[model samples]
Target: MQVKKADGSDYEPNTISAFQRSIQRYLEEKSNLSILKDKEFDSSRTAIAAKRKSLVQSGKGNKPHATKFLTYEDEEALFSSGQFRDHNPEVLQRTLWWYMSLHIGFHARDERHKLC
Candidate 1:
């Protein structure tokens, strides 16, 4: 059996499971994106660490903005900056599947209740 969505597209009979799988896939994709973000952040941190170490070892540690390099605080600050906030592609897909699952489940229960 097939179910028709509001857009006139036929959703397969097992749409609940399909929606669940879609949600899981979206979560996995989000997790992968987060890992990529972390790797980028780590690379930047490593670069900053190298620069700081070079400057300090050369007897220039007392210069202005030297504290920024002292404890690698600059990396922490940059990581928290909103530089990669636009990378969430699966957010809308996940939301749509979630809403569709809720709607489908609610309607199914309502129909069962009406027949009882």
Candidate 2:
């Protein structure tokens, strides 16, 4: 199907195949569940599945960020600064810590939660 471009500038070619595949996988995984036997259970399960599929199909899923990923140059520049070294004598230790932290992804969403 054709839909508006993600950038919102003009029409573009798009398809619902990704969403459909996610739902199909969910149904296959839960094929043993009887929808007719339990109304409450089935409804709740379906709701959760749909929510998960929606999150995956959208860019809001629980995966790594595409843009703004750190590069080797950025990491080196951050750790090699003299100001940062002056505060901490354990230069190597802190450098390794920052490297691992960046590799694993950050817990803070912004500067407000940074020190926390």
Candidate 3:
């Protein structure tokens, strides 16, 4: 709870929860206490839960928006529009790259550097 991001902002609820889990694991491995199951840790668990709820209410830790997939008709339209044409080498290369990335489950932000 005392830690913050480099920009001095609070960590997201998911990150905080992960930190909590790590602490619990460490304590369990090194000591006899179990934050998850110990009655003594009930107040600590409640505090963490409340913090997570507060962060979520403030629009943090929400899932990312789902990526929209192209319908069959949309794909056909793109093909018809010459965007995915076999005749144009540049367009064909781009189309292949796009489809290959999707098929390989490469996230643009996470895998772009590795691919490049």
Tens digits of per-residue lDDT, candidate 3, 1-116, equal 35678998877898888988899889988999988889998998888888888889988887666578889999889889888877879998878877878688876776856875
**lDDT ranking from best candidate downward:** 3, 2, 1
Instruction: Name the runs in model 3 displaced over 4 angstroms.
Output: 1-3, 65-94, 97-116
Which tens-of-lDDT digit does each residue in 1-116 have in candidate 2? Answer: 22234775322112233444566567669885433345646664565556556646664444353457667787567757642344666765665556566666666657325633
* Model 3's TM-score against the true structure: 0.59
Better of 2 and 3 by TM-score: 3
Query: What is the clash tally of candidate 1?
Result: 0
Q: Candidate 3's error at 15, in angstroms?
A: 0.6
TM-score of each: 0.22, 0.34, 0.59
Q: Which candidate is the best by lDDT?
A: 3
Q: Candidate 3 has which clashing residue pairs, if any?
A: none
Could you tell me which 10 consecutive residues in candidate 1 have the lowest summed lDDT?
62-71
